[model samples]
Target: MLTDLHKQLLNDFQRDFPLVERPYLEIANRLGVSEDEVLSALAELRDNRLISRVGPVIPPNQIGASMLVAMAVPEPELQRIADIVSRFPEVNHNYEREHRFNLWFVAVASTTDHLARVLDSIERETGYLTQRLPLVNDFFIDLGFRLDLSHA
Candidate 1:
């Protein structure tokens, strides 16, 4: 269950996150709490799986090259191959989907060549071919979600 402070933390800071040296302190000041309290609350939220992470969502191709890679992994080898793919620092988000391409992930690298090498390594290591789909254009980018903690 979320408290009012937690609800405020989630809804209010979804955007315009403080860009100060002591960001948590800034948030704490705004929320009328100590910096340690803010940090502890965020840690608690993470531990409870109420939030995935607290960070900036950089636009694709803004910082580096990124691609959506999919693999048609066998059911028995899904977990093993997924683990191998997740080991790469380039692989940021990986999950299983209900499709022929059961395993899907997003990989970002410092350059296109680096992204290609990462994909190649994944293929070589996993012994599974990957379909790399580079971003053509961004239609919509929504990273914010509404958490109705009022009921909590």
Candidate 2:
């Protein structure tokens, strides 16, 4: 169950999230509530699977090396390998495609060497070879989801 606060929080702060020492507190102030209320609501939203995570979405390869990696994982091993890949903090997200190289993901690191190390570790652990596709151009993709919270 979501309240007006939760709806507003989700809809208003998708972009231009306050970059402050106490962002939640700032949001609380803006919403005319105590910081604890905002945190509690956010926690409740997380617990109910209404939200996934809160973090900055930096441009790819801006502060580090970024790679679009793919793996030809057998169908039986897909879920397990995906779980292993998701454990790495460098991996943003992963998905499956209806192709031989079905498992695809993006990984970012502070440096090219660090990215290589992460890929190497993935290969060593999963026993699957990594195929990194080079970035030839940049495209802007909006990352916000406009929730329809009318029922809330």
Candidate 3:
């Protein structure tokens, strides 16, 4: 179970961890805790899988290029293919999309050619044809779900 202080810190700074030189110090000061405590609590939360990551989530097309690629991986070989897909630095997120192309992943690249190279490499490695779906039009969907303070 998390202490109240940890919960408060998570609620306050989950979206925006400051980009200042001493980010942990700033957060610690705001939360009335030591920088070490903040770091420890974050580590604990991550270890427990309460949070996926504690960093900036830059939107697609903001800096580097991104695409939603999927592959029709066999169900028996999903985990193996997923592991192969995760080896690439270009892949930031992966999911099992429910469609003909079941293995969906986001690939961020320096250029279009770089992204294509990743796709080609995956095709060669996994022997599965990748379907790259570069965003033609993006709709910003807010998937924000507040942690239940009542449970906290």
Instruction: Report the Cα lDDT for candidate 3.
Output: 0.84
| The candidate that achieves the highest lDDT relative to the unseen native structure | 1
The RMSD (Cα, Å) of candidate 3 is 3.3
Q: Write the per-residue lDDT of candidate 3 for residues 35-121, one digit (tens) a residue.
A: 998899989888888888788666687886888987898899999999999999899899987777789899999888888888899
Predictions in order: lDDT: 0.90, 0.89, 0.84
Against the true structure, candidate 1 reaches a TM-score of 0.77
TM-scores, one per candidate: 0.77, 0.67, 0.70
Candidate 3 Cα outliers beyond 4 Å, as residue runs: 16-26, 34-36, 76-84, 87-89, 124-127, 137-145
lDDT of 2 at 43: 88
**Which pairs clash in the backbone of model 2?**
none
Best model per TM-score: 1
What is the lDDT for 126 in model 3?
A: 94
- Candidate 1 regions with alpha-carbon error over 4 angstroms: 20-39, 47-49, 141-143
Give a tens-digit lDDT track for model 1, residues 1-152: 78777888788888778888999999999889999988988898888988777898778999989999999998999999999999999999999999989999999999999999999999999999999888898975675777767677
Q: How accurate is candidate 1 locally (lDDT)?
A: 0.90
- Model 3 clash pairs are none
